[model samples]
Target: MQDLKGKVILISGASSGIGRATAELLASKGAKIIVNFRSNEESATEVVYHIKEMGGEAIAIKADVTIKEEVNAMVEHAINSLGKIDVLVNNAAGGIRQSTFIDASEDLWEETYKLNITSVLLCSQAVLKHMIPKGKGKIINISSTAARIGGAGESIHYAATKGALNTMTIGMSRELIEHGIIVNGVAPGVVETPFHEKFAPNDDRLTRMSASIPIKRIAKPIEIAECIAFLASESSNYILGEIINVSGGR
Candidate 1:
């Protein structure tokens, strides 16, 4: 049988980039999927259509994970439609603005934390009840390389939020392991996603960053998706509280 044939997975930020790619890949493997998006309804619907076209089961759910009520509603909707969620991929994140900590506004910092760290906390909490009852679950947080290698002239706020996520993953894993739930993370490096365009927007900076990678190339969303798939699958049963880097050896 396929590793995830009978599993139900919930993925946040499913409108684009790594989240969208992971949703597609997991759906192809026979997992019933709940594709959650804060905005970009069209893109989320397109993802669902693609999954359905491939003969995969999936549904697009609207939710802003940063909000507790919305996060709860999202999990409720998924459980109502798919029965129960066996996996939760906390992939929703904000883009980084090119500003140093001293120059950054307090609002930007707050927004970054809300989207990055708060969302993970809210979604994870919402899903815990369902997962604990079943006695097994997987939670994968899509973190970033910036959390390890801080960016210059960029949002220290965004990087800090990611670092908080890493800490949260570790702490949550320890707390949840006794319940038979596995918590892990994937910290991706420079990927060719809309995120960079929204932040850096400098073609030259993009080229330089790509060239700096050990592999001399940026990551594709699918490449990160594959790593997330492994963590979410039984193949990584023994690997808990680990953050797998998919940053092309950067």
Candidate 2:
């Protein structure tokens, strides 16, 4: 509906969940998609195959977003394969392993920062070179409500990294607006993604947690994808430096 046709877009962590949903939705609207995955080559290819089945253009590239060199190379591949990236969805993240502060090791905190915060910075920086020259672009970072409402007994380090990301979004938006690049963020709350099945395996606790939300349900992956799509579109031209909460009233 937003006429993303012919636009080139890159999505990290696109093997499954919200990233995968975003890829499918954007591809449906005719954007040339670059699916970035870390280790899930089969799942990544499946996403690409589905996009192509719908007559959409897409390619899957494996890259560890947390690593600067890999992220930079992925950006290059996306640009070379798709021409130029008009929209960059910084959806790559890796802080789902929840651990208490005292229990969290230095390595855990370090890894959280590298994946959740640093990756966003590197990916955005890589894309900005091309984006600025073109004089228009959109960058959407996927954050979490945990960033604001701190997950209890969970990884405080994870929440801290997300908060840092939100801050970076605000700062980057201020600096890049003059360059015609809009930077924004989406903070999702309790989205029902594959991460949950692995992280919260206790059915009883998971059910109780789901019921605790004001909406009494977890968000669908597609819902978050929809918001990402809107932010990446021209419809959000006037919205800048904003972090839209997709938390279902949480």
Q: Against the true structure, what is each candidate's TM-score?
A: 0.97, 0.97
Looking at candidate 2, the ten consecutive residues that score lowest on lDDT are 149-158
lDDT of 1 at 30: 84
Model 2 spans > 4 angstroms off: none
lDDT of 1 at 133: 84
On the 0 to 100 scale, the lDDT of residue 89 in model 1 is: 96
Q: What is the overall TM-score of model 2 with all chains considered together?
A: 0.97
lDDT of 2 at 5: 90
lDDT (10s digit) by residue, model 2, range 1-250: 4778998999999999999999999999889999999999999999999999999999999999878899889998888887899999999886758788888888898988999988998999999999999899999999988889876447688889989999999999999999999999999988778876766767876788778788888899999999998998888899999999998788
Worst 10 residues of 1 by lDDT: 149-158
Question: Which pairs clash in the backbone of model 2?
Answer: none
Residue 117 CA displacement from its true place in model 2, Å: 0.6
